[model samples]
Target chain A: MSERAKTPLIELHGLTKTYGAGDAAFQALKGIDLTIQQGEFVAIMGPSGSGKSTLMNVLGCLDAPTTGSYRYQGIAVGSLDTDQRSLLRRYALGFVFQGFNLLARTSSLENVELPLLYRGDSRKERHRKAVAALTSVGLATKLDSRPSELSGGQQQRVAIARAIVTEPGTLFADEPTGNLDSVTTRDIMELLTRLNQDRGITVLMVTHDDHVAATARRTVLIKDGLIESDLVRT
Target chain B: MIWNAFSIALREIGRNLTRAFLTVLGIFIGVAAIITMVTLGQGATLAVKAQISNLGNNLLTLRPGTGFGSRAASAGVPSFTQKDAETIGEQISGIAAVAPVRTASQSTIYLDNARACAVTGTTPVYFGINKWRLAEGRFFNDADLRSGAAVCVIGDTVRKELFGGEDPVGARIRIGRASCEVIGLLAAKGQAGMGDQDDTIIMPLSTLRRRLIGKTSSHDINQISISAQDGMDSNALINDITSLMRQRRGLGDNQDDNFNIFDTRQIAETLGATTQLMTMLLAAVAAVSLLVGGIGIMNIMLVSVTERTREIGIRLAIGATAREVLLQFLVEAVTLSGVGGILGIVLAFGLCAGLAHLIQVPFNFNLRINLIAFHFAAAVGVVFGYTPARRAARLDPIDALRHE
Candidate 1:
């Protein structure tokens, strides 16, 4: 195996998360141990309230695990401060939500330029990079269109462009096509697959749909706050 | 980073233009009120000083009164004589001029026009003591005073009311029961003290005592106006006059002088101080509105933060640090108040100018007060904006994202 294949991009050991305390305490994640390799497309599948969203939040560095260790590229993520985690998210991670979170009344070009703005990129560079990213997603002609003016599929495409604008190493999509129709869902999944294969960007998506899970090379099924099955497509 | 924050703030404020304007209105009114009060107050104080200066420098007035406030009510005290004024002018070394004044109110008539005005009887030295100038013809001379000439100098108000556009210098006007020729016109001096100085008529003390009052004796005078020579110590001159008056009145050392001596310059200073105190109080009251304006800003900002919780979450997810979010909201607050400050200044300038013109006072541009008010408004923004900004910065990304 090559060195890139030998090293995992994300490693979670005995990770657990709980909410509230003293009689109202409830465990959302019960000691999950998962690993995702570089340049791999992985899908996390689970039913409603099976802790898949909580796990996705943890992997995206949006939340800290209550117990155990989470490492991104061999560095302990839980030990990092909020600012450091923010930097990590800025440089190494991207997120796409189910609701397609784009700023209202802003052009798609400016929306896509947000991540680059946080990176302290010059305005010209941000514009150039944002255009290139939008073009790669076949949205070069819709740069000036606002999310409210666009369709559901188009808004999601803009969200994806925003996510990948900074060229982070990994993309985390939590039910990215949840709000789309079946035809648009297939289109979005195809785009994710193309990004994974052509750009070699690692993609970790959480979905309950088997059809969405089928697009990934590896699948991990979560039940009762723990991994019940792990499968390889081949 | 500053530019980035500023742009975001600009965009957010622009997006909600109406709400933003309404939110800043409180600051606008507060700043305008403070600046208007202070500027107009300063103008009023300056106007009063200028009018008092028209009474001339190093001037002392001896009135027949022993009480505080107005010296017009001298019923209990004995009036000074013309001899007393002449004695001071001759015996006092630093005396520049001493004019004995005997005042009486009369309705002067000219043709069919009649107006109530003050008729002041004094010598030619009264013009020099008051530094009054003639607008037309010439002032009464010693010949006029000695001969008891029936001549008078009409003020601007009297000239306007009685003569209309016609020149009153060579015309005749009735003073009380005596018909006097208008020999000269006193230049306009506007208003002073409790009445208009330009509305009075000045005449020779001998002419007024004989013709108007029908009094043959020249011993009775209402007051004495004394002017000290240039470079003379006014206090020493006052001391000299006080002792001379006491001796003339035969008052013992233990007895009161039975008279009043006052400085017109000190009166102007006192008026200035009173107006200054009032301006400060008005400004302080207006500053409370600024504090209330700050509270309004805080209230609106808190609502804005809550309304944009999801937006904050989105920003956090896009790698913006909590400090960045904090800075963004703080910049927004400062921008709101800063713009309001500028607008208030413009409004105040217009309002104060209009008010000063209406009240016949000069418009004073006080840059120090304007800048202080502007910066203070901005500071209010920061202080009141802190809590909401901190609340925004401390929000958990997950919970914020989940917010409806």
Candidate 2:
């Protein structure tokens, strides 16, 4: 088969991230090579300390890889300076944490406005976009309810609104339902699936749950520091 | 961006209101203590200067033998007489007037009203030599001085203390076994080291010598005061008095003069230097409290960073520049300090007012210094609030996201 002519969204070659140094140095990621195509929703699965989270960080540009080349849309992301990397993070990446890290004492609408604020959006645009985002996450009715006032499921919905408000190129979710109950987890998964299927949003989510992995069209499993398998099952 | 950071800071402060309040309390107390203590020190310096300047500037006091602290308490000294004062005034070139003083203290009882007070004995020129004003009747004249008249001038304080403000002028007041008519009221002069100059009765030296008490020796004048003319050189006047006194005392060229001439202007430098040193010391002491306040700010910032770890992770993951994170936390710190500083200034002024009334220190209510202190407090907040904010901003998001 001809090599895919379409430019990859993320390309990581010989990627490694180490912690500490000398005899105490522990390698979290060891020579990981991965490619993600445009608009492909993927899932990463691994046991604890398998370096899946490390892989996600490199993918999200939250950190630099220890010794590797990371190309995002043909620009060497791994080589970008702090400000350039910040610029990349500003316009290209969205993040959802497992614990539903919604800012306390803030409205759902304002939570969605955070990423837009980072982009220096005008106030009117910020408000309109935030409202639109809350509508997308089915949080239009809970605009003013604080994080403490919302249930785990509703809080997760608010967090999802926050993530996509910027309309970034990629959405990275790190076990987005780890702290939620099973029913709430299912609801959040369905929401993620809708974003991937209907809106053409590229999503990479990390989860140990097989059910969570099943929602994605492709799943990659890592054991130790290297990827053991990549399965495509639509 | 600064406003946004400030809002976040305000919100964070509100999140844990108790912690914020306690943190600000440290800065507030430090600033307040500094402001109040410095104000007191400034007020004391001003009061002392005013009192000394009001005593007289052109006048010099010559005490017999070596005198250090007070006018009357120099020991082992051969006393000088009023005749010495007369000689100095007549013989010296630049001097305009001379007066010698004698003092006594006793219990005065007049018709069932009794109070203890001091009495001063001086010449008719005593009123002119020092700036003593007559509030009621006339002061002693040349005719009275030459006749050794039994007329006296009593101060407002003496009138209030002894006669209950019943117009002691022209009243006959008894001093020991002698009776003297109060010729004039000396008016209010506030306090002096002469032990409340306003609380004394003034009488002629001749009357005090003849009627109040017999002379124990040929020398009874406790202090001899010389006032230089308005257009005359005070140093030259002093030299003339020194030479004249040396010749009158029969001291040879090698012998050091036993008398000491003190100028009120000389005390200004010594007192001014002392006051400045004391003010700096007070300010330094206050600065220690500011250090404790800074520690308080650091402690609270550390706690805030710890509590907001997950939030920081979310911010970083969502494209916040590290500088932004740093700025937001820095704003929180600065906000605490700024508000604390403002409140501290208010508290300081309040403390000054209360102390001015209670402890009775001089308070001019200096507006410029007050403003400077407020701004300084804000600056302290900035200086002390920077590092912890930077530390919080620099936290790694990947690790922070996993932080419990």
Candidate models: Cα lDDT each: 0.91, 0.82
The residue pairs in collision within model 1 are: none
Please report, as a residue range, the 10-residue window in candidate 2 chain B with the lowest summed lDDT.
B66-75
Off by over 4 Å in 1: A1-5, B68-73, B229-236
DockQ of each: 0.77, 0.56
Off-target runs (Cα >4 Å) in candidate 2 are A1-5, A13-34, A46-50, A105-110, A122-125, A223-234, B1-7, B69-83, B91-93, B104-107, B114-117, B146-149, B209-220, B229-236, B366-387
What lDDT would candidate 2 get against the real structure?
0.82
Residue-wise C-alpha lDDT for candidate 2, range B271-343, written one tens digit per residue? 7568867987998888788778978898878877888888887788788888888888878877888788888
Most accurate candidate by lDDT: 1
Residue-wise C-alpha lDDT for candidate 2, range A108-135, written one tens digit per residue: 8878888887787887999999999888
Candidate 2, CAPRI quality class derived from DockQ: medium
Determine the TM-score of chain B of model 2. 0.88
Give TM-scores for every candidate, taking all chains together and pairing residue i with residue i.
0.95, 0.88
